[model samples]
Target: MSEQAQQTSNSYRSGPDERGHFGIYGGRYVAETLMPLILSVEKAYKDIEDDPSFWSEFYTLARDYIGRPSPLYLAQAMTKHLGGAKIYFKRDELNHTGAHKINNCLGQILLAKRMGKTRIIAETGAGQHGVATATVCALFDMPCTIFMGATDIERQKPNVFRMKLLGADIRAVTSGAGTLKDAMNEALRDWVSHVDDTFYIIGTAAGPHPYPAMVRDFQSVIGNEVREQITEREGRLPDTLIACIGGGSNAIGLFHPFLDDPGVAMIGVEAAGYGLDTGQHAASLSGGKPGVLHGNRTYLLQNEDGQITEAHSISAGLDYPGIGPEHSWLHDSGRVSYAAVTDDEALEAFQLCSKIEGIIPALEPSHALAHVMKIAPDLPADHVLVMNMCGRGDKDIFTVADKLGVTL
Candidate 1:
């Protein structure tokens, strides 16, 4: 694509300018104390970003350890039911640790090791990232500490157990609604205090400069593999791509490689807890305005006074007040369309996917599935739609059961 076409098409192939601003959405907005460390991280990551040996190790780990090339399977049952678009699932849920989180974890752990960091720290909402971080830390023989919201720890007990089993020290964050945002706050405090030895592995594509770009690059493996697999299967790119947007790691992963493919449309689903009008949803792009949070300027769920508000979602993973800056940029540039789904809608889609595809998807992607269920039936039968089933439902069974009033 020519430079003019790239710029006009909103392909956004080049982004996060030298100072880390993604069209004013992403930048290193940090305290002086954390600036040096963040710059060090940026330098370390940039050094390896082009290193063949670094990628070789990352690829080897992704294939042998985390299980790469997650399949893109056509969901025939879902397609027939929708009777319009042929739905295909990018099955990253089958990956090690049962989520796409491990992909970035492996990449960052390798970076941490290269930096001679001896301790690993991370913040998680749904616990998937925590478990992924703990798993890599265990593999690398590094001491791991995970900060999780107390409410998340309660609702996502299975993941909590998994993180503990992986030998991680789980710290419950009890501030500000006791959810992902609070957990991130605690993790940042820990990192700032222990900058000498701790490497903070942020779960999502949001954070300071290198983090959003770094996590998105690591997770882009999902999109890279999708491009190859779908080309082999359909002989061309799909008509549209769909994925849930929490901190947008999975969605960005699946969307990045296809950014320049103007023919392929992209959609990101956010948790619209009750509804956008209810003031209880987490649909950041849909209901939020841009503001600085977690060291980056992005669309944030904040009140008129600029205080961040608690986000509501059935899935703990999607209950975040802000999104990754890249997602904010994409939304603003109109490169990617953003939509919202309600808790009930996601739950219904969750059960429908379970019954039809025999895949019990984690609630996060179920939000995407909800949108797919809505639009697929309206599109042409020949139309193709790909959705990222980013994580398995095993960790969410208890929460689902409680909502359904079932004894697990």
Candidate 2:
């Protein structure tokens, strides 16, 4: 394919900028204390990526270790209930650490090894990323530290325990609102200090340039396998693909390779908290305005002074104050549609999936399932649809039960 042909493809991420900045959206946004370290890792990633041997080894490790061909299972019963749309699931929940997060974490640890880094640092909100990061560090024998909000430490105790079992040092950030934001602040502070041998493995595609792109690349296997499986089963692409967007990594990864197919639609669901108009939400594209933050220019949930506002999503994973730059661009270009699903609807869908499909999905991905409830009913029975059921919801049952007043 010509460069022009490839350029026009529906990929959410683009550009010639090597440092991961998509236009002005992504660039180094760290404190001056960490600039040199960020740049050093950037250089290492570029150099190692250019070497065929490293790519070969990385691909081998990915296919074998992380279970690259995560099954694309046909949601037969769910589809029949929808009464028209063929719903299949890209089952990343069965992955090594039990989500798409592990794909990126393993790749990052491999990169860290190549870079001669001896330590790994990461920040987590709901702790999925922290557990995945810690797990990979254990496999590589690298010292690991995971920063998490003190509040999340308690809410996601299972993940914290998993991280400890994997031997990661956990620091519960107590500052600010004591959530993902505070944990991120603390992690960044640590990066600025331990610039020498630390590699920070971000969980999603939202961070600075290469991160969004890199994470997408790591997670893109979801879509890659989907393409092959869809061809074998349905012989054509579905009319739409739906995935929840926290930092937008999974959605973008699944949507990127399929971007240029004008006939196929991509939907990214965000958390609506109570409702979008209630001032308690995390629907960045649906509710936020353009602003610069965290080292890149992008749409930010902000206040009157343009200070970034904290975001609210019942799903801690979706409680991000800013979005990946590529998502902002895709929304602006009309290449993708962004929607919001309220917490009540998400929880209902979460329960429904477990009750009906025998699969319990994370609250983050449950946002996508809520939209599926709305969408599948409208499509023709023969039409196709697939959702990224990102993780299991065993970690969320108690909180969900308390919220909905379910005795169980």
Candidate 3:
């Protein structure tokens, strides 16, 4: 990568256009009350992006405080059995609070302060993002409220306790399926009710317009580091980059910077509960049609009428009916190949990685691992593959243990 090339890439890294639309997929979709604040945020971000000093400071915070440029470790043992391409784990699991959600949380907290917003609110499922948001809110000494589904609060009890300890007020949403999307709806309702001073820190890259764009920009550190590190380690960009799509944030972040790289292959794996054929799946791309849901025009697992269907997946995180708009565009443009993984297959991979690599991956990444099991056995030996392990599995112990017929 020459200086000229690097400059060109960075120039388009956050853009091919601003105003937060990614090829007509993303734009600011907000109520009248938030229009001014959203615009102000857009302007402030543009100003900050232009300031090199701000980036220097932000980079310092990322490296020293948040512990970033997270390691891209070669899964030597896993790859040896899978045969072909060397496997690399972009270990976002190593980040604070056991997931990559911290990257965006910290960045959002900083942006909220820059915009003079004092209170922060967000939605969470599995409580990973909630914990991350609570952690940052604690660090910033800001009032934080997290709306989580009642079911998640029950299942992910440890994380809920963690959030309370971090001083976040947890609101349990009981309507709908009592899961991630339900919590999102309640969170959105809260935002609409209190649109004055509260900043909505959306956990994923799925929300309307600027949020998906903003979060992706903040999380692009994964791709930025991958490009540099892979070039040094394997002497080139990876042939295939994979990440699990739960609201599509992490996948979009890692894939966005590499989209224009023609030689790079990208994959987004969604959760397939029982199986797509069984109609009990969260395979949004495979089992869904394009529809408007949760503010973005994206593929959603909807029914005959307009009502959103219940999403089912063993992986609590990927159990959503809709994906981010950018993912919908990527699917339409053929920029990304999307696939589904069965709950059974995911569990197998979850156990396999634990036994082999000594890594306990979140069920979300287990879907990606399921795909890797199939894809790796076929690719050339020298081909390289990288997958983002988005989280750890401590929050999933009860579910996994029961599924395996074990008792505490």
Q: How far is each candidate from the true structure, as Cα RMSD in Å?
A: 2.0, 2.8, 3.8
Candidate 3 regions exceeding 4 Å error are 1-19
Best by TM-score: 1
Model 1 residue 346 lDDT score: 97
Angstrom error of the Cα, residue 256, model 2: value is: 0.9
- Please provide, for model 2 over 1-408, each residue's C-alpha lDDT reduced to its tens digit, 9 standing for 90 to 100: 223322233353455266665545667676777777667667767777678887787778777877778888888878877676889899988887878888888878888898888999998988889989998899889999999998889888889999999999999899977888778778878877888888889888766556767777777878888888888888898778999987888898788888877888899999998899998888888989888766566777888899777788889888887788878777776778989999999998998889889999999889998999898988998778889988778778877988988876
| TM-score of every candidate relative to the true structure | 0.97, 0.94, 0.94
| Candidate 2 global CA lDDT score | 0.82
User: Model 3 Cα RMSD, Å?
Assistant: 3.8
Alpha carbon lDDT of each predicted model? 0.93, 0.82, 0.85
Candidate 3 clashes between residue pairs 3 or more apart in a chain or in different chains:
27-209
Candidate 3, which ten residues in sequence have the lowest lDDT sum? 1-10
Put down candidate 3 lDDT per residue, 275-299, tens digits, no spaces.
Answer: 9999999988898987776666678
Q: Which window of ten consecutive residues has the lowest lDDT sum in model 1?
A: 1-10
Candidate 1: segments with Cα more than 4 A from true spot: 1-11
In model 3, state the lDDT of residue 138: 96
lDDT of 1 by residue, 1-408 (tens): 233322323548677778888877889888788999999999999999999999999999999998888889999999999899999999999999999999999999999999999999999999999999999999999999999999999888888998999999999999999999999999999999999998999999999999999999999999999999988999999999999998999999999999988899999999999999999999999999999999999999999999999999999999999999999888877889999999999999999999989999999999999999999999998898999999999988888898999997
Q: How far is 14's C-alpha from truth in model 2 (Å)? A: 3.6
